[model samples]
Each structure stands twice: as C-alpha cells, then as structure tokens.
Target: MPVFNNKDITLHYATFGDKDKPALLFSNSLGTSYQMWQPQIDVLQNAYFIICYDTRGHGQSSAPKGPYSIEQLGQDVIDLLEHLDINKAFFCGISMGGMTGQWLAINHPERFHHLMLCNTAAKIGNEAAWLERAQLVRAQGLKPIADTAASRWFTPSFIENNPAVIKQLSDTLAAGSPEGYASCCEALAKADTREQLKNIEVAITVLAGEQDPITTVSDGQYMVDRIANARLATIDASHISNIEQTQVFNQLIQQYLV
Candidate 1:
C-alpha cells in the first residue's frame, strides 16, 4: 500500500514516471478510483511524472463519513504534490476530478503547468439530489447501480463491444465501499464551481464528450466560455471519452500539453 498522509486523511496512491519530468495528475469520476485512469497512466507514464490515487474512502484509501467539500479535495491534491515536492504539473480530471482541477486552479494556481478538464461541469447537480444519492448508496451497495451506471458513464456501443472491460469496471464498483461511494456523491451534489470559476485564470483545455449523458457538451462549452483562456474540445465518446476514443483523445491531450 503506497500511502501518504494528507493530515485529515491518508491517501492510497499509485505513482509512475520520474520526478525530473513534467508531472501529470489524473482524477477519476465518482464511484470510481484512480484505477479508472490506469489506461491513461499506461500511455502517459513515459513522458510525464504521473500521479494517480484513490480518494479517501473509495479504493484502497481510508473512508470517512458524512460530507467533504470540493475545496478540501483540491487541497488534498496540493498536499500530495507537496508531499512529493513537485513544483508544477500538467493536471487533467474527468467529471468530479475536473471539478477538483477547477478548484485547484482557483486556489493553487502555482501547482500546475497546464490543465485539461474532460467530461466536467462548473456546477454539478444540486445538493438535494446529491444528498439523496449518498443516502441511497448507504442503504444499498454499488451492485444495484451497475447495469444503469453505463447510461451515465459510457455510450451503448462502447458498453456492448467491450463487455470484459465494462464487467471489470462494474466489478471495481461492486467491490467499492458504500460509505465511500455515497460520501463522494454527496460532495458532487453540493459542489458548485460556477462562482469560483472566474478565479481560475490559468490556461485550460476543456474536453467534452458529445455522447455523454452525465456532463453534456453544453456544460463543457459553458466552462470554455466562462474561463478566460479556456478552450473546448468535443469528442464522439461518452462520459469516459478518453477510454472510448483514446487515440484521438490522447493525441489531442499531447498537442495541448505541448
């Protein structure tokens, strides 16, 4: 267990590449852990100092109760970077991770060299809905959501063609702690980055999935329009755009990183 103390929590993380190179940090979506970004790690490891970690509670990390704010999550990332003594990095996050990236840009501008946010929104769902999700997940395990999870995470074709991958992902969730999953959902439901987005003056690239049912393209466009130097790139995949279309997504990210 590669763990680092973040004061409030101990984070279970996976680190790759080397310290001398530019760093790339990836954040996964809700109900998912850093393992969700393993594919990206495989691709980016050679060129960047890659950091991927399970948020407190979800994967191999310790789980706490009740609620956690997005700012706290962003701060955790900063703490991790400080733990490693990384001055700057290339940050990319999907969905909840994207929100974290936005928060980081607002409060910890010096931590990143470049930013890429995919399948994310400035304001996630309202608080009531998020709290409800947390409550339900606490009552039931992740299995109940497995079949329907794809509706929000991946398109039909991707799910149908990649049964093995989907099964593995579903299994990952099925085994996840209900408390941890629900707590993150609560964090998302109450998270609204709209007011704070103006504070993010860093250059950013927003990647939206055209077929994404969760955070639609409009959400991505909104971020692009709001953030001063932010640009939007729309892909044909669903919420997990990078997974569905890695070739195009990876190439675009590489171009943006350059």
Candidate 2:
C-alpha cells in the first residue's frame, strides 16, 4: 500500500515491472480502484513500468471534502510524478479519468509523451443529471448506483458471461464511501473540456467503445476531431472496454507505445 500525500488527500498507488522501463501511468474510471487496471498490468508489466493509482475519493485514497475539481485531479497526477522523481510518462485514463487526462494534456503537455483517453467524453452527461446523482448517492449511499452500474458499464453479453468480474466491481462500488463518490460526481458535473480540447498538443489516442451508451463513439470522435494530434480506435465493448476486451485493449495500448 504505497500512499503519497497530496495537499488534503492521501493517494494510494501501485507500481509493477522494472523501474528502468518506460513509465506508463494508468488512471481508473469513476467508482473503480487502481485494481481495475490489473488486467492491463498483467500484460504490459514486462515491457513498461506500470503505475496505477486510486483517484481521490476512491479505493484506498482519502476522500477529503466535497466538490473536487478537474484541476485538482490533474494536479494530483503532476504531484505524483514529482514524488516519483519522474519527469514524464505515458498516460491512460477512462471516463472521469479521461477527463482528467484531457485537462493534463491541455495544462501540462510537456510532462507526458502520449495520452490514451478511453470510453470518455469532453463533456459527459448534463450537469443536472450529475448533480442529481450526487444528491441521490449522498442520501441513499452507493447501493442504488451499484445496482444499476452493470447496465451502464458493460454490454448485456459481457454482463451475462462475466458475472464474477461484474460482481467484484459492483461490490467494490457498493462498499465505497458515499461522500467520496458524491464528491467525484460534483467534479464531473463541473468538468467540461469541450472548448479546451483543441489546445491539447500532446499525441493522443481516443479509444471508443462501440456500444457505450454513457459516452458514445461520437463523443470519442468529437475529441479526436478537436485534438490536433489525436486519432480514434474503436472496440466492440461497452463503457469498460479494457475489462470487456482485454486482449484487444492490451494490443492497442502496446501498439500505441511502439
């Protein structure tokens, strides 16, 4: 349990493979811990030094107060890099993590070599919906969201075939801190990078899920179109494509690193 203190929060992160290898940092999606990247770490660890961290308010990380901002999330990454004594690394993020990646690319372009944004959007759902969800989570805790998360996170077939995996993730979500989850919801509510996408100059790859209802392929394309040095790649999965299609996702990431 490697933890680093950043301002008001303590972030938990794990690293794998040789330190001399090229560093590849992973940021998990909302409601997931750094364990969500295990599938990727299993495959890429031999080649790259893989770093995975639980974002503030999730997993082992401390959930401070309400309404975390995207800038705060982005700054956390910068702080982590400095703590590790690494000047730069390749970055990958999903959903809310992807939004953080976008903010980093725009604000700290010099600190990364390449960025992969998966199953995310420049502007996720409307602010009202996010705020309402935050309120609901605060009132009733994570059970309601956990109950409905499968439908949004995985395709019907994947959910049916991968019951164990789905259960583990849902259970993690159900057991998570309500305040932490709600605070992240508030962050997503205010995180809109649609106008700022064009300013990102770092090389980028947008990994879209063909059947993601939450953040559609069109959203990925919207990002690819706006970012100066970005391209789109599609996989036949839903929101959590990396878990749904691990081999293909790993291959794509390896190819991008090459």
Candidate 3:
C-alpha cells in the first residue's frame, strides 16, 4: 500500500511482476479502483512490470473538494511515476483514465514510450450533461447511477451471463465517494482535448468497444485521425471492455506493448 503524497492529494499505487522489466502503467476508468485491472494483470504481469493506482478521489486515495481539472488528474500520474523513480513507461488507460492519458501524451510526451487510450474520447460528453450528473451525484448518491452505469459498462448479454462479475463491479461503483466522483465529473466536464490531440507526437493506439454507449468506436477514430502515428483497435465489448473481454483485451494490449 504505497502512497504518493502529491501536496494536496495522496494517490494509492501498486506494482507487480519483475522490477527489471519494462513498465506498463494501467489507469482504470472513473468510479473504479486499481482492482479493475486485475484481469489484465493476471496474464501480462510476466512480461512487464505492471503499475496500477487508485486515481485521486477514488479507491483509497484522497477525496479533495469539488471541481477538479484534467491537468490535476494528469499531474497525479506524473507525480506517481516520479515518486517511484520511473523515468518513462508505456501508459494504458480506459475511460477517464484514457482522458488522462491524452493529457499525458499531449503535455508530457517525454515521460512515456507509448500511449494506449481505450473507450474514451477527446471531448467525452457535453459540459451540461456532465455538470448535471455531478449535481445529481452530490445531491443524492452514486447508487442511483450505479445500475445505469453498469449497463453502459457491459453489454446486456454479458451482464445477464456474468451475474457475479456485474455485482462486483456495480458494488464497487456504488461504494465510491460522492465528492470524489463528483470532482471527477467536474474534470470531465471541463475537459476538451480535441484541439490538443494533433500536438501529441507519441506512438499511440486508440481502442474502442464496439458496443460502448459511453464512448463509441467513432470517438476512438477521431483520436486516431488526429494523432500523427496512431492506430485503432476495436474490441467486441462495451465500455468496460477489459473486464467483459479479458482474453481479447489482454492479448491486444500485450501485442501492442511488445
């Protein structure tokens, strides 16, 4: 349970596999913890030194006040890597983490070898929708949105078939801190990296879930089109494709990183 104290915020991080191997940092989606990456870690750990962390305001990390910025979220990753003495690593992030990955490759390209952005967009949803959702979460709780979110996370067929997995993921979402979740919502609301995508000159791979309602395959294409040396990889799953299609997801990532 290593904690990287980044001034106002504290990030909880974990590492796996051999320290000598090339590093591959996995950043999870919004409202989920580092545990969300377990499926990939189970297989890819042998080839790469895997690093996963609970983003600020989620899963054992500090939940500061509302209205967080994308730069703030991106800085957390930078600080964590610096604290661990990691100079550079391949970054793989999904959803909100993908948004963070965009900022990293754009603002700090020197710190990464490659970027893997999954199930995310340069500009997610409209600011109004995100602000409204944040307001709703602050007023009520994450439980109200948890079920609907779960639906968007996985396909209906997968949800129906994997009852235990759905419950586990949904429960994790429901248990998130309201302030933390809302703060991230604020970050998403203000985030619009469409203009900055062209500036990212790093080798990048953009992944999208075929059935993802949150961020569709078209969104991934938009990123691939903007970045200079980038390509697209489509997964036959929903938003949380890593969990719904673990084997395929793991294989794609391992292939790309190598």
- Pitting candidate 1 against candidate 3, the one with the higher lDDT is 3
Q: Residue pairs in steric clash, candidate 1?
A: none
Compared with the true structure, the alpha-carbon lDDT of candidate 1 equals: 0.84
**lDDT tens digits, residues 1-258, model 1?**
589977778899888988787888888877788988777878888888898988766788877775778877888898888888888888889888898899888888877877999899998777888888788778877788765777678888888899887888788888888888887887787788788777788889999999987788999988888888889999999998878898888888788975
Q: List the residue pairs that clash in candidate 3.
A: none
Cα-based RMSD of the predictions, in order?
Answer: 1.2, 0.6, 0.8
The residue pairs in collision within model 2 are none
Q: After superposition, how far is residue 43 of candidate 2 from its true place, in Å?
A: 0.8
What would the TM-scores of all predictions be?
Answer: 0.96, 0.99, 0.98
Model 2 per-residue lDDT tens digits across residues 160-257: 99999999999999999898999999999999999999898999999999999999999999999999999999999999999999999999999996
lDDT of each: 0.84, 0.94, 0.92
Against the true structure, whose TM-score is highest?
Answer: 2
Instruction: Give a tens-digit lDDT track for model 3, residues 171-241.
Output: 98899999999999999999999998999998999999999998999999999999998999999999999
Ordered from best to worst lDDT, the candidate numbers read 2, 3, 1
